[model samples]
Target: MNSLLITSTEESTGKTAIALALATLASAQGASVGYMKPKGTRLQSNVGKILDEDPMLARDLLDSTDDLAEMEPVIYSPTFIENAIRGQEDPDALRDRVAENFAHLATDRDLMVVEGGGSYTTGGIIGLTDADVANVLDSKVLLVATYREPGDVDDVLAAAESFGDRLGGVLFNAVKDADYDRVSTDVVPFLESRGIPVYGVLPRKRELAGLTVSALAKELGAQLVTPNVPTDGYIERFVVGAMGAEAALSQFRRTKAAAMITGGDRTDIQTAALEAPGITCLLLTGGFQPPGAVVGKAAERGVPILLMQTDTMTTIERAEDVIRSGRTRDEETVASMRELLAAHADVDAILQ
Candidate 1:
């Protein structure tokens, strides 16, 4: 059976989303696809059973019946690092365990898609890093990297150096619009010349990065002030209305869909956000409720008002953390991801 390991240069590079998309695409082509996350981070509790979120998402999306625990061989527990440092955890045994799980999961499968931990070198302390585990599983690496600046190409090259011949290709993800041209023009050629194929270049998609208003409100513990507002819509960016009302309006107008976060006391900024065409919702800080007129206007415009006790800085940070934490639990996101890949990515080459 063929094995493709999806890993990243660092955390939150969208490895799970790309892996699920490519796997879904391959499965559509009539191949038996198996999934695994050798070292499960981003722990969660499902049905009173503790497991990683990525594997659970993959399992549900791929419709695999394999046991979750078996699919994710290693769960990063509270004291996992402490135990590893104290020499209580055996490296060779853990390696064997992961390999054994891969073998079992690979049964009668045409391809196995393994997701590594946070980054390529995530498990270096325990000898379970992506390179280490790939060596044991004999899998080729599909490196998903984010290029905020051109210098990031060096980061990809550095990671590729470690994988050497086993590097299947690189997928430049979440690339900014400004940097996409250089990545497609100069960077792709350099990498391909070095024997590493460039499978895809996906610009940052707000839909893929966005969190629903309802989900954001729930996660932030904010109170919904407006009645019967649509909270199911997604908000891509959360802009802090720290500047003057005029400046804030200009910024808010730029985003196609975003939540304007400001102090509840900043009535000017609040009013401006309400008038802006792109403001999907308003996150008011300091637990202060908006005036009846503001509330009426928000309700009239169908914008949700989420009130929270946390200050502006804290709320902005929390919202960012939520956006950075990607998701594939919803069908809309799944469908859009496939569309993005089909248009921009070489799904056939990568899976082939």
Candidate 2:
């Protein structure tokens, strides 16, 4: 079977997104696909067993019958890191478990998409780094590079050098409109000249990257003050209400489907946000109960008011964490992601 290892230069660069998209494309072409994440870093407990989030997502999306436990063979729990650092955990044993699980999942499959934990060098301590796992599976590497600035090219080049001939190609993800010209006219040509193949350049779409109100509420441990708010509604931008009422309104007006974060006591800011178009939700901090008038107005405007006990900065940090770790579980987002990947990414080249 042909195997591909999907990894990134850093975390939250949409490695899973690209992997899932490729699986969909491959399935459309009548190829049977299998997925496995050898070393899972994002640990969550479902009932009694510890599980990784991405493997479960893959199981559901790909319609795989593999047991969740087997699909994610190794989970780095809170104490796992501590144990590994102190020489309590054995790297060889971990590798054996991963290999055993991988063999089981890859049975009767044409392609196996193995996802890495974080970056290329993330699991070095456990001897299961991206390159290590790729070598173990005899898989070619397709690195997902998130475009932040021009300097990001250096990071991608360095990773390419590390992978050597094992590197299949590079996919440029989340490229903003402003950087498209440079990435296409400059970066792509530059990389191609250096013997690196550029497989895709996907543009940034807010809907694909933004957090939903339901996700935000869950992340902030927030209480919904408004009844029957659409939790699935996407918040494309976040505006902190630290300025005066007019300034806050002006800022909020700049983006669609914005979530305004403000102190609960700031009725002026609250009122301004509610009045603005495309204000999907309000995130009230400091545990202060919003006045009944503001709540009533929000209810009237059909805007969800999420109340949290944390302070403003803490609230912002929590929101950032949610966005960074968030994935698209909804069908709408999934369809858009597939469309984007199929349009921008060279699926033919990847499958070849």
Candidate 3:
């Protein structure tokens, strides 16, 4: 009977990660939890099957018996969005489908964890936004926001107005250590005074954020030129090799466990990256191929070379986006979330 909808202020705010963590936490309390994502946005080829990855992950992780199709009744595909915007798709009808799905999962369940797509405003075109669906399900809302700057406080205030009485609280997740003091001292007090409940402030530790070399290649759709190289290395961050070879080498030296992005033609920079420590993978841009010797050196050093079609700027942006989007997948991340939420969040209140 207790249904909770997990949404966020922006995309890639670890909604799925936090949802999975909360579901497990509730289960540990002897409550039978059911999971559903009424709408999925990150559709991808999961093991050669094209579907929404989030729902599949939730289903597999929870060991639920509900069909994937029923668990996620709607996907925010391009065609679906286009039809919805053109008035061919009905909002209320789609919402009814979501409600129907929830009905199936609610049997003998003590709690239901529903995850919204993209952001709370994702389904606004069809009028089935997170707030809309939450109202339909009569579920309380938990807004998981990432605090990148002080201005992020505005997003929480705006969400409080939208959720109104249904707004359980706001959890400041993925808050970098640098911004911790400011959020705890200044931001938390401001929200609390204005009748907003600040549930948790979780830090962005490297273990929860790093992406494997294999995941980077898979998510980016890049071709791995060196197939025999190490693919499991963690790329904690990425750097662009736009500067001179000496300058770029200096950056590669300081950065640990990173993917170096540069043009394939910049053989000197590529060589420097190979020489530097902790270069897990090399991303070659603009479809250019590095020389045989460069490839040989990379392979010799056990570094994987990925060929990307985008230019330097676009490649950098895409890499950053991938890191943010793929924040949670493996069991390692889920385990880390348990400790994090227990330490910083009011889990008992959030679930109840």
Which of the numbered candidates is closest to the native, going by highest lDDT? 3
Q: Residue-wise lDDT of candidate 3 within 1-352, one digit each (tens)?
A: 8999999998877788899899988888888889998887877766775577777776767777778888888978888999987899988899889999999888899999999888888899988889998999999999998887878888888878888889898898878889998888999899989998888899886767687888888878899999788798889789899999999999899888899999978999999999987788899999998899988999999998999988988999989978766654766677788889999999998998
TM-score of candidate 2 versus the correct structure, residues matched by position = 0.87
For candidate 1, write residues 1-352 as lDDT tens digits.
8999999999888788888887888899999999999888877678887788878878888898998889998876757878988988988999999999999999999999999888898888789889998899999899999988778888998899888888989998888788889999999999899888988899888767677888888877889999689998788777889999899889888886788999999889999998888899999999898998899889899999999999989988878877766643465666777888899988887887
In candidate 1, the residue pairs with backbone N, CA or C atoms under 3 Å apart (3 or more residues apart, or in different chains) clash, namely: none
Best of the candidates, TM-score: 2
Screening candidate 3 with a backbone cut-off below 3 angstroms (N, C-alpha, C), the clashing residue pairs are none
lDDT ranking from best candidate downward: 3, 1, 2
Clashes of each: 0, 0, 0
lDDT of each: 0.86, 0.85, 0.87
TM-score of candidate 1 versus the correct structure, residues matched by position: 0.86
Tell me the spans in candidate 1 whose CA falls farther than 4 Å from its real position: 77-79, 82-88, 218-221, 241-257, 262-269, 272-279, 300-302, 309-317
Worst-scoring 10-residue span by lDDT in model 1 = 325-334
Candidate 3: where are CA atoms >4 Å away?
Answer: 46-50, 221-233, 236-258, 272-280, 286-289, 292-304, 308-321
Q: Candidate 2 on 303-336: residue-level lDDT in tens?
A: 9999999999999887766666655445466567
